[model samples]
Every structure is written in C-alpha cells, then in structure tokens.
Target: PGAAVVADAGAREGASKCPFSKENMAMEGAPTADGLLAGERYIAMNRFQVRDGSEAQFEQRWAQRKSTLLQLDGFRWFGLLRRVPPTGEAPDFEYPDDYSYVSFTIWETKKNFNSWRKGPAFKEAHGGGNIFSFVGMIVNGFMTSKGPPKPAFWRSMLMEKTSDEKPILRSGPGGRPDADGQQTLDPEVFVSMNRFTVAEGREQEFEQRWAKRESKLDGLPGFRYFQLMRRDQTPDDDVNYISMAVWDDRAAFDNWRNGDA
Candidate 1:
C-alpha cells in the first residue's frame, strides 16, 4: 500500500517530464500508456431525467429492448442506473441526484462508437421507434422525459477495482445471473459521479494534484470501484473531467461522506 502511494506520487511528478500531458495524449486503441487510461477504454453516459412515476416504465423500456451491443465490436460494459434517495434521516445530501437514470456504456475506442453508428446494428437497435409510439407515449404521459438527454463521454485516467466484475454488475436484461433472466433491480450498486471543469491550461496541474493527493478510499467499507476520467472536448472547450465512484450501496457512500474519508 505504501509502495503504491509512493509510485503514484512519483508518477505525478514524472508526468510533466513524460511529454504526454492529458491534453496531448493520443486516445485510440487499447491497454497502452496514453493518458490516465492504460488503454483506450472510453466511457459514454446518457443522463435522462424521468418524470415522477415514470421510473418503472423508463427502466422497462431499456430492459425490454433488443440489445445489439454485445454483437458490436469493441463494446465492453453497460449499466442502466436509477438514482437512489437517502434513507432514514441520513441528513439530506448537500446536492441531490441530478438525472433520474443514466445509461452507461463502455467502448474499446472512440472509433468503435463511430463504426457502430454507421453500421447496421445501430439502425436495427432503433428500428422499433416510430412516430406513433412516440406520440402515444407523449400523449399518454407514459415515461415522460423531464428534459433532453445529457450525454457525456470520457477517457478513463485511473481506476481501482476492489471486487471481481466477471465483466460488469447487474446491468441490462440477460444480465449475469446466468440462469434466470429475471434479476433483481440494480444489485445494491450506487454510482456517485462529480463533474469538474478545470481552468484553462491548468488541466495538467489539476490532474497532477489528483494524482498526488492522499485519499483513504482504498479499503473503505463497501467501496467497490472508482475512476477518474477526462471528457472528450475541444482544447478550447471546457476541460471537463469526472470522478466517479461505485459503492456497494448508497448507504456506504453516505457513510464515507458522513465520515472524514
């Protein structure tokens, strides 16, 4: 553990001399030293704000869909997450959940996403959507969306996997139960993500600060996973990045926040 801390510090200092700043790092194909990501693992999430009482229908929409993601090349992981509310007077979170749900997906590279968009799989995936269904859903107030979807894409810079994924957690339909298709809702997993827009030209310094900062998240109870990532944007665009953590449950996160860690 101490050795890891030392190595992380050394990397923080050495990154400036390594010639690859987060800005200049190449973002393409797998497991190589590019940016923070050892490989070209890209993440995409579409946040959707489902109106009150439409949550079930919203989730069912995804659960009932015919997925072609597995058949596509470079598709890695996917998860449909629902925001969890605080339990039993856990002093309300300073900031409440943003969107009601997020469709999280991982790809081998940015190119793979483009390929999927142009290929037949993408078309087939949306083949069932028609104006009639859209009109009906809107008119019937079924699964009404609160707002337009907000999409965010990122390249992972760091991650800590505390438990075995066997690929990923209880996500979409036909999930890892392996026997019965009917899996329980979202498997006690809670995702906490924060967005950061660093000052211009301070991207490297910001990243270094994160690399060197001391954190006691390693062995925190119920901590399952964590990742620091930089979003895809123009150099002049806001230097957006995200720090995402996955816990055994929301209560676990609440404990960490309630405590000093």
Candidate 2:
C-alpha cells in the first residue's frame, strides 16, 4: 500500500540473539541483510544486481514465482522494487550504485521470521521443496554474474509518515503476490535509501545526533514516508544504519535534492 503509519517501537534488546541462523554475518547493526534481530518489527531487503540486460529476467522470476509468506506468521508486507536508472542517461548507463532490485519484506518480529526461514514454506517459496535446488543455484550463478543478493536488515526506529493506514490484505486466487489480494502502489512512487556505517562504540552517539536534529522534511511535497533503521550488532561490529525516504516519484526526490531545506 502507498499509505503507512508510524508503528510503535516496543521493548527492545541491545544485542539480539540469533534465532535459527547457521552462521551470523558480522551483523552488529546495519542489521544483517539476512539475519534475526531482537525487536517487535523488522524490515529486511535482499538486494540483487543482475547482469546489465538481465533485469527483466530477474523480475520475471519473482513475478511468476509463488510466495507463501502471507500464510506464514510474522509476515506483514512484501514488495519488489526496481531501481530507477539515473536521469540524463542514454543507452549506456554508468552509475556507481547498489542493488538493481530489492525484495522488501516486513515482519512482526525477528524470531517469527527465523521460524519461517526454517519451515517448509521457505523451501516451497524458494522454488521446490528442496534444501538446495541445484537447478536454481546454477541459474542464479549464471544470471547474476554482477553479484549475489546483499541482505540488509533494519529495526524501525522512527516511522514518521503521511498516513496512518495499515496494510490491507484481501482474498485472492491461490494467494498469489500479483493477484487482487494486496493494494497496488502508485506507479510513480519512489524510494531512496542511504547506508551509514558508524564507528564502533559511537552508535548511541550517532543515534542521539539523529534524534536531536531538526528535520525539515515534514512539509515537503511528494514526500510519503521515512524511516530510520538499525541493525543487530555485537561489541566489535561497526554500527550500520539505513536512512530511507519514500517520495512520489524520482523527480520528487531530485527536487528535494536540488533544493535547500
């Protein structure tokens, strides 16, 4: 849905434990791209950078595939976002950037998400009911030579928004992601995110800085939603944080960037 609300940030743990992961990915915060954190609600993204001309094929995989997340607990929202190529670009695109596609998901809690990961639904949604699908693996390697999915996760710190409506789910045929079960987002909406890595031991200081800063985005045109997300971290980890903002379109974002607050 285009509309979203500021969700409550309930009891939080300093260092979240691993729910069911085989190995931790040094995720002491920027939130493990693929990890379990201690929190009430979690946002995760699996970013993919396919070969130069393979974007359509990658999206097709998600569009045609079946996801059983709605049937699983802790699931709240899922969306496939495509990066808008830099403006003023011609046939040859050159931009030092991140993921070309992001598979976004929202969960009620970290534990619930880990549970689903270890459940049969994980296997089923990943194509077939196999732990390691050799066919899928081969295809992934051959298709995404650019890079594999980078998992980035975050816990909602502040959810300032333009609306208070929660995501609405309706009945659909076989509960397909593209069916009429979910609300459609405006085609022009855009999301912009920046990754920050704070020096170790200064995470709290960084957060305090953000909390105390005066933001001028409240009344901006085309602004839809904003979030400050943090990751699970250990003592030795460099704190990672993601600042995300949702706008009406790419032009809106550019306008904000070109103007002074």
Candidate 3:
C-alpha cells in the first residue's frame, strides 16, 4: 500500500482567488462555496511501479487491506488499475516494461479521508514498510485531491452521466452517482492516467486546450469516460492537474492515439 495522500492545504500567498474558505485556516475544516463539508467529495490517485514477478503478491496484499478502508466513513469506490501493454501501435508516451498500477479511491468527504490518514489503519496500511517488503522498487505518485477551482469547473470540464435511455457501464465497489450524476469505473476497462504541471499564469490556456481536445477525443473509438482534476496548491507547491480516461481496452486506446479521432 504505497499510498500518497493529496488534499488542499488552504490558500497560497499570491492566489487571492483561491476558491476555498479563507476564514477556515485549517485545511481539514475549510468549506466549499456550496456550504458542503470541506473536502466532502474528493479523489485520491495512488500510483505504484511494481517490480517483476511481484504482480500477484502486490495485488493480493492490496485486496487484503482494502477491507480496512471499506469500514471507514466517507470511503467510496476504489479501483486498482494496471497498465496494459499496447496490442498494436503504441501511444505517444512510452509504456515501460516495469508496469505501473494506480489505485483510485473516492471519498465522500475530505475530513473522513484525513481521519483515516491520521488513524491507525492508515499507518498500518502505508507506514509499516510492508509495501517495500513485498513489491520491490516501487514509486508512488499522489495526484489531485482539492478538486476543481469551483463548482462551475466540474460542470464545464468533467464527464457527465448517460441519459436514462442510454446503457450504463458496469459499476464497481464504492461507485456511486456524484452530484453531477457521473458514475464510477466499469469492470475490465483500460485506464490512461496523465499528470500535467501547468506553466504559471497559463492555467486558463491549458484548460481551454484540454476542453477543445476533449471534444475530439469523446468521439474516438472505445472512449468510455474522462475526468480532469486540479490538485490543491500549498504555499510550497505549484498548481498541477491530472486527467484520466477509460477505454474498452488497450487496442481502443492505441487506435485513438494513432488516429486523428
């Protein structure tokens, strides 16, 4: 369980337009503009690079400890995504042999997640050095947790739900319809995770490019769902973004990457 926790750490010195509550200096207590619990809805992406011959053991260990989080409040759905090799042509990015796996967990609220982090369960799961003992040469990358800058950002940028007339994807554990009606991951899907470090003062430009590309990507073969996330910025950290796309399989993903779509 090589997990890195990500969450908003309150306002930065220069970001006067930070969407979180200024009065609530404590990150755990800060509230969203909608008056919902601070960090009420969040997603944590924990990426791990597993050594050869330890894939089965790493997955088994993950399964055994997953139950610990299930008992915790605010814990929602969790998906363990494994990187698959491309069948045909490869994508623009390199897919190394040392396969990467990412655990994406959704939390009902940030406070509950924070509690889990501070509690004994979190310590035993992530701090016991068990992960290193089982999976050699692992690198964990923690993605965004602060969510979008505002509620409007989600409406404009995130994936929407299927209509009543349309067929829905197979749901997984802790998977629930969000306020915007988007469902979680389906079984047997291939996931593409991309993290971006935006150039300072160019956030809007990056978002615009993403929005434009998303429109084109939506029509591509095997495309399932897409999510764009903004990581919470602390005083010492720079603002970053992460995007995830689910496809039917590696072939579908490869097709989209190689074609114009």
Candidate 4:
C-alpha cells in the first residue's frame, strides 16, 4: 500500500478541471438554459394568515376542489406550500405563523388564469375568501426569463412526475417560519427552489464545478446556505434536480439575481 501511494501519485497529479464544465457556461442554477423547460412558465399563489383552528377544514376543501381546477384548459402544474420561519426574528413577521398555507398553480397563459378566474369553477374553488376562514390568494406575475428576483420561500408540497400529473396528496403543519409545530422554517429565511436538468454526459462535471462555485459564495455576507437536491423515487421523465438557497434579506437575494453581488 505504501509503495502503491508512490505509484498512484506518479499516475495522476492534481484533479483535472471538471471534464464536462464546457457544456453550458450560463449561471449555475439558471433554469432557462435547459432545452426541455424553455417554453414552460411558472405561476405562484400565496394564501396567508390562515386561521389556526380551521387548518384542517381548509385543507379538506382545497383537496376536494384542486382537481377541478386542473381540468381547466391550459393548466400546467400546481403546488401548496407553507412558509418556513427564520433564524431569530424578522421585523415583518408579525403573526405567530406569518405565512400559513399557500396554493401555487401554474398555467400556460395569463389569459388562461383570467378566463378561469371569471368562470364558475374558479369562483367556487378560490374566488371569494378571507384569512379568518383559512382561505386567501395572491397571484404572482408570470415567471419570465429571469428566475425569482428575490430570495423567498418556494417549495413543492406536491411535485409531479410528468408534465401531465395528478398531484399525490401529502400532509404537514402550518407555514411561515415558526418553532416546532409539525412544520418549521427559520425566521430570517428567504428561500427559493429552482429546477434544472444537466445535459447528457455532463452530470459529473456539473457537480464538480458547482462544488467550486458554491465554496466561493460562502465568502459573501448574508449568504446563509445553499443546497442541491435531486428528487427521490421519481419517474424517468422527471429528472429535474432542485437548488434551494437561503439569504438574509431580499436585497441580498436581488443583488445575486441582478449580478450586482
């Protein structure tokens, strides 16, 4: 073994630059560069201040009705998420659970959502509501070429295997960062998840390259953490890996997205 060490040292010197680094030089986690997802768009909906006691009833109702919304033309994908709390406390996070429950549904067009909102189905599923009743909705504008402009919590309570999917149901506690209440997230947390596909034969290289790039990111201030996760038990067509990152504030997140930081 000792003699083999000398032989191995003579065999290869330093680690070679990731062999597959040349495939796509765009930003590490940018989603638009991948071919399969180019035309796809994202829509995010957030419902806040859900009443503590009514959480069960609220989920029951949404479960009963979510499938109907998917039936609408142009509907793409959907997710329901709860916010995570921060490390210490946030100035804006007033209520115990500042973010409780939210439903994010993606569609093919703004027109698709508009048409559905005005139709009877939308009204029945999500049209009129109040936070006290454990119901609320905030529709974000379409996701353009730029990914999320700021560091914010975005997760898939239910992610699909194929483009056409029937979301399998899962259960959890409240949203918005809070202490151990079945569901927990940090307070100063501004988190977001972006999905990407590594080009064929480039997976190994991409991992090596990201390891180097992420190491440098730690030197910057307010950078909390970055994680790369691949879905488990996923179908063949759904090979998208996720990158979830945390930051101190929106300005810090925006700086990274805008290339200023």
Candidate 5:
C-alpha cells in the first residue's frame, strides 16, 4: 500500500491545455485513453519547503519553470499548492513553516512523463541552480538514466478514480463560497496529501478499503474531492499509493480526522 499524497491549491496557473474538461470529466465512463480512468493517468507531485520569506521567489521560479512543462507532449495540468496553517493546534506530522509547498501535475501516461524528463526541457528547467536545489541534487544525479530515479521525488501514478468522485471546478482563483456560505475549495483551500506503501499483491484489498471509507467522507462537511494513486512500480520497489483530499478549511479536515467521518 502506498501513502496518501495531499496537495494544496496554490501553484501559479500555466496556459496549458487541460485534458479533463468539465463536460468530459462529468461523463460516466470507463477508464479512457483521454479521460481520468483508473490506472490510465499519472500524477507527478513535487513537495517543497522554501527558506523563510522566500515564498514569492519560489512561486515565481515555479511559474517560469512550469511554462516548459506545459510546452511538452502529454502534459495535462499543473497546480502549485500551499499548505494551509491549521486554525487550532497543529497536527503531529505538521512541518515547521519551511517545507510547506507542493506541486501537482497530471500526465496522460507514465511513458509520456518519462519522455519529458529525458528531453531538453527537463535539462533547461532544472539543470541550472534554482529553488529546487533541495530535490534537484537527487534528480540531477540521474540525468543520464533513461527512467526515473529510485525513490521517486514525490511521483505517483493514478490507480483509481472512483465513479462517485466529483470534480471540484473553480470559477476563478481563490475559489468562491457556495450557496451555503461554505468556502468551495480553490487554490487557497487547505489540502492533505497522504502517501502509503502497500505490500505487493495487496493493491485490490487497499482499494476496497478506500471505497468503503469514501462513502462516509462524501457526507462530511468541507470535503471536496479525493483521488487514490499508486506509484509506478520498478523491478525492486515495493508497491506505493497516495490518497489526496481537498477541503474548504483545516477545521473541516480536522473534524473528519478526529471523528466525524
């Protein structure tokens, strides 16, 4: 079982073409080559913790770098998510202010993502010294390799997108409040990324558990969307998964974690 990966919504928007259009995504269908079907799509998640007061610089560099990804083939959509601070006391896993940002990208396939990493764009965007130095050091070391490095830098593949899952579309930046006055999730809403590592041959069991728990989550307040993802498997790697959830605020998330769900 892989861990759940949560991504907040805070990345600079790129002018890329999103494969999952509102109409198309709303259709009830099987996993299609062009749609978010289970086991068909890949998600690349990059987590970061910028130095103090450098959030603006980090975002600017990310926006510039994202333009390169958008121009590549198979690129779908990208979002830079900032971790929202809890209104009450902090959770145990909460990091200090430093490592609080995450980048989420969707690709058509793992092969497509691998190709982009080997192409010139990857070199230009990440070769030079930038804010990604923390993870770049590990990434750059594998520049000569054909596939991604071992222990991927927060990369995971889409294993399951349940039929009941709803797409949380936003009208604009920062999202607007709903009819009930509850804030609909946008880039600024709090997000939780949970990652897991499952033993081999247990993928089906893991998904079953998720399906059962998801029903209760749907009824909770502030819960917006959820996606269960598995990491691309290598010859020697154990199975991995990520569960991503979006929430209107920290209180709602904490409520579910505490007991409501």
Candidate 6:
C-alpha cells in the first residue's frame, strides 16, 4: 500500500527509520554482477494511495531517498508506478479496475528491511497517521537444495533474480482491470508473502500437496493463475519461496478466501 502525500516537513520521521547502510549506497550506470546477485532475501510489497491531486508531491518525496536507499545492506530495486487502464489483452480471469498506484521494493533479508521499518521512515511512509499507506510482506519459500556444488546456478537463480527485480505478477492478465465495471472486487489486487514449514523429509510431500491445491485453484471461477517459485543460487536460504496469483476481482479473491469459491 502507499503512504499518504505530505509536506516534506511532515515526511521526516527520523534518520534511523531510513538508515544508510552499505547496501543502500547509490550505484551509477549499471549494477555489477556481484552487486546484482547479492544474496537471498525477503520481499516487501507496498501499495500506496498518494493524496488526491498530489502525485507530484508524492514523487518528489520518493526522489529524496533514491541514492541513499540504493546503498542499503540488502537493497535491491524499487519501482514507483501508477495504475493503467485495462486492455483486451488481459485475461478473462483478471480484474481490470483495481489499485490506482503501488510501490514495490526488495530487500536482502528481514534484517535489511528492519533498517527503514523500525524508525521514522516507516512512520513517515505508513505511520504518522498516514491513511494513504498500505504495506505487505513477501516471504521466501525453499523448495530444494543441491548443497554447494552448483554455486553459480544457485546464486544466479536463487539469490540474484529474486533480489530486487520486478515480481512475476506485476504485469499480466491476472492484474489487469475490466472496462465494463461488471466485475467487482474487494481490494482489487492484494498481494502478500507466506511461509509454510514442512516437516523434515516431507519436502516432496509438501510440493505434492501444493500442486494439488494450485490445481484446484485453476478450476475456481475467479482464480486466474498462481505461481510458486524459490530463490536462485544461494543454498543456505534457498528454502524461501514466493507465490503470486491473480483474480477476476476483489469479490472473486474474497470468495476463495471465504471458502465459497
């Protein structure tokens, strides 16, 4: 979710809330191979509603922190975007009209995220009585491990790709909004990260279980698509996984949640 647009004076909560760490340092031109594939980390997805008619102000506020955020310990990438009109290219299962604007950021780990969240930055971004803000967590789920023999592949896929690139669901049929207004949704598109701990030696069984659940999701009316993925190269934290899905609308997503789908 998005934080409310406020005067710059009101935006500053404290420095610790938006700490300057090694990862937050700004990089110029393009990122290096080592820099891009830092390590496996958690994902934090934020949706914000900038104050009405204050889109410019909201963008200005974000501009102030670009360089600093780049150098943070686990800093990956950040995208600030506005909603677009729905197109026929969108899948029938997708909700055309949803959120107006959203911002997505990636961090190397929860610890890295804590830097900005624990202090003023969090309050300024979402707190401080900011009704214009919404935030959600994206968890990493591990599916496999090849020990250390395949370090490059592991790092490239697990650590690098998942670090701060755009999420899989960003632009797809599942995310598009409808033009007719015939389909109503709850919150439009609401994304979150989840973790399910399986018993040791039950990894295969767990995958099988999810496969069944995901298969059933496909048959549901509002359910468009659901994706399950694990991080790339690093093994110590490869268990982390991410699930992204799209629905027909808010009501459709709610129906599934309520067990009415």
Error of 1 at 100 (Å): 2.2
Off by over 4 Å in 4: 1-39, 42-44, 85-97, 126-261
**Prediction RMSDs, each to the true structure:** 13.1, 10.0, 11.7, 21.3, 12.5, 15.7
In terms of TM-score, the best-performing candidate is 2
Tens-digit per-residue lDDT, 79-162, candidate 5: 667665555655535654234555676788777876875676655655344433423442232122221222222233333332
Model 1 agreement with the true structure over 1-261: per-residue lDDT tens digits: 000000112223323211112332334322222344343477866555555555555555456555689878899777777665545554434334345566788788878876875676655554444312322232234323222344566777667767444334534554433323233244447788777777655667777788777777877888877778877644223437778888877778899889887
Model 6 clash tally? Answer: 40
Between candidates 3 and 6, name the one with more favorable TM-score. Answer: 3
Per residue, candidate 6 scores C-alpha lDDT tens digits across 1-261 of 222232222222431112122222222222123223233445444333333445443443433322345445777655444443333244433322233444556666657776765655555553255412322100001101111001111111122122223234332212333312222222334443343333444544544555555244556655654444433323222343455455555566567677843
- Candidate 1 — which residues are off by over 4 angstroms? 1-40, 85-98, 128-147, 163-171, 174-188, 234-239, 259-261
Descending-TM-score candidate ranking:
2, 1, 3, 5, 4, 6
TM-scores of the candidates are 0.66, 0.68, 0.52, 0.34, 0.52, 0.34
How many Å off is the CA of 150 in candidate 4? 18
Q: What is the C-alpha lDDT of each candidate?
A: 0.56, 0.56, 0.47, 0.39, 0.48, 0.38
Model 2 over residues 1-261: C-alpha lDDT tens digits?
111101112113332112122432344434233332234468766555545555544444455555678788888767667666555667366546544566777788877777877788776765475544422442344234433344566686666676544334432224344433133333435788877877656667766777777777767777777777776544222337778887777888888888885
- Give the poorly placed runs of model 2, Cα more than 4 Å off: 1-40, 86-98, 134-142, 164-188, 216-219, 233-239, 259-261
Clash pairs (backbone) in predicted model 1:
31-39, 36-157
Summed backbone clashes in each candidate are 2, 9, 4, 13, 24, 40
